[model samples]
Target: MEKIRLGKTGMMVTRLGFGGIPIQRLTEAEAVKVVQRCLDLGVNYIDTANGYTTSEERIGKAVKGRRHDVYIATKTFPGDAEMVEKNLELSLKRLDTDYIDLYQFHSVNDMDTLNRILDPENGLYRIFEKAKKAGKIRHIGITSHQMDAAKAEVKTGKFETIMFPFNFITSEPAKELLPLCREHDMGFIVMKPLAGGMLDNATLCFKYLLQFPDVVSIPGIEKIQEIDEIAAIYEGPHNITSAERKEMKRMTDELGTRFCRRCEYCQPCAQGIPISLIMTFPSFVKRLPPDWYLKGGFIPEAMEKAAECTECGECEEKCPFNLPIREMIKESYSLYEQVKAANTK
Candidate 1:
């Protein structure tokens, strides 16, 4: 039931917003039930993207009668003007709504892509502008994984909101993006607060974010218990206790600063390496179902491919966060060794 002003958008959304990704894993009826649970608990903001499989369609079915009760925000990948409009039309049809509360350009990672998308003549902004005029979308916003791109979007003063990854381990955005959002009065939509499911303690994550009441966070939901837990946080102690802080420190210390966010800006490696996936294989193995590992043999196959890095420095240069690609791949190799040893036992 707790709400905050969504910056210049002027829409007061619940601090605990609904993320649309996890619902894709559920059956259609189950997904709709999960969404209804959030809305029924007085949490009123939802975000979905075109790439999240059936997220948009499930959300559409969930809000069948009470569309006005919740504010729906969905995103589309960048495309030409016509293609962008097609995405919007399809989203509207999927959501079963004529207008969306917010429509964003999803994943504009670097300035080049940002500039191209914002280009007045050749980019998708004109299409968004036209759609805004036609009442297809009420406001325009953007989401990014890189700090540079996120900061640039805010500086342009064109977007109404900015979504970025911000958890205890990945607090780089707080250095500048947070201040810029305040200065520009742009809404801050938080994603990956749990570090893409790497952080197991959801209560700790939600409590940690309570210090920033001005921002809204959308942790992907696929269950009624998740919303109940968030509601309990709102009703319970509003600050991190000493025990909670110690637990948080332990989690962040274990995760460390070298986590790969899977941004994929460093793509198409000349050595035929999936650098992002290779770097994150350890985390994926931990978070997925137990049997997904399935003897963990092919993990070495992928890690060996990453081990072929020529140390050419090309991938590190393109990485927005300047991650040490070779070093992390080596770390992944070490982790794979441990997994391999365990499986052999």
Candidate 2:
């Protein structure tokens, strides 16, 4: 496995790292097995978050005595100094680590949040600096769902790494973000490398991302097969043919531009629906069949059907892209129900 330096964070990580989000779906034993497999395959970078349920605890259990084999990075979702400190403390305790390799400011969406985090008095920088001085964290980075906010952070020349969504579908903004990271000599970690399991062609997507210099794509893994597949991608020469590129463009166009970017901005559903996961059912079902939803028999029962919508419009009001999210959810629910009905019938 080849390693790339994570920007100015002064840590080198494998081109293929283990993402912590999807691990939440796995049992403790399963999660540990997959994470250890990642280490065995030379994947040294692992990212997790305090907000991701029990992901941190799983990583702590997985690494156990072999913590030195991987570079651990986790995010703090603290809004203010007090919360930031507490979040870090909890994350460190959960991960059973004394020092974090890279501590990121998690998912800043707009300039107001950015300004608040950058502020010295009541903001994140104070706590971040305090933590760094205390030797609890070695370097600072930022992750964002918005391209504009990520670009803004890169220009500041303060952060060592910048994580954002990047896939064959959203390669346009990535073209800009990629070069900017290189110019600043910052590590670019790509989340949603598969576009939330929408894009079926993982080989092409991973190959396309590798064309950019100094990028590390961490595909979320739960099953051992996923871990092995990603390991193959890292070990293989990630190159795309001209024909594949043409086909990729055609497929993405057909998939439409409104695919869930996995921004996680459409959260805290008033209905407690796990709206993001539910809304993305179609994409995942199409790409990765025999998924958890299917095995658990939740799709046909637990999901909210499109026709059941009461038009509360809460999701629409919060969407930043002004997406026709209500209509999309309606469309997704209907489509999913139809598929399930057909399969069973």
Candidate 3:
């Protein structure tokens, strides 16, 4: 219902945009319905990615006749110029569009990766510049979970926007990165506004983020009900009431210790365990039905993968949040086993 300027791209996007990740799990027809519902509710910014299996295609199909009604943004993993070029073509094809409104280099976590993408000889930035000049994309943006990478990109003044995790629990971005974006006139897009679904109250989540006027949050939307819930917030009060703030404080305090934001920096576990997935199981157990967790790929085979962790501490070194990932994995595995046993009974 309300619009904000998307940095120097000069595109006015809705504060509550459509995040395309969850739509990948839905059937094409189902995904289309959800996306159309978003547009029907006047949500005009659609953020998807080349990495998200069929997200781009589904958004493309849903917005076929209504392309002009939305600003389409999508991303690809960082790579050399040639690889980026290839991915760009694939995204264009999948979206069935001539040009994307915003194109981002996805998940750049550190300065080294940022340098690689910005390198002139073989870097992806050059290709993105060319694409912009050729009208293949309207603007270039970058997304990352790491604050260091985000700060570095903002200093370079290369990207028109920066997408980062921003919620009550993860407030690091608000301190410096957000101020930098404001100073640079760069659009600040808030990803993971609900903290990877750890924060269940969508109304409070939206209220918390709306405090920062410049930031646009794209929470993952897969169901019309989610759209309805978010839309209700748009029509309601804009400011966070004192009571609401108190409730937020309580929720954050409760979740402060054990919650995993799923930044995925603690990746490539030595035992070949998916640390993010394993750590996320506990939250799923709390919020979702056991059958939903199992059918959603939290099967025994996957849960048992956590048992392979050697507790070597390598993942902890890389974890920015300093979570006790080792113990968390153990606890998550135990919960998974208990849930599985109970479900079988």
* Predicted model with the maximum TM-score: 3
Which 10 residues in a row give candidate 2 its minimum summed lDDT?
A: 286-295
Which pairs of residues collide in model 3? none
Cα-based lDDT for every prediction: 0.84, 0.79, 0.87
lDDT of 2: 0.79
Clashes of 1: 0
The residue pairs in collision within model 2 are 7-186, 7-187
Report the C-alpha lDDT of model 1 over 124-171, residue by residue, as the tens digit. 888888899999999899999877678899999999999998887777
Task: Return the TM-score for candidate 2, rounded to 2 decimals.
Answer: 0.81
What TM-score, computed on C-alpha atoms, does each candidate reach? Answer: 0.84, 0.81, 0.85
In angstroms, the error of model 3 at 199 is: 1.1
State the lDDT of candidate 2 residue by residue for 279-311, as single tens digits: 677755544443445545545454654455566
Candidate 1 lDDT at 20 equals 89
Highest lDDT model number = 3
> Arrange candidates by TM-score, highest first: which order?
3, 1, 2
Sort the predicted structures by lDDT, highest score first.
Answer: 3, 1, 2
Scored against the true structure, residue 306 in model 2 reaches a CA lDDT of 44
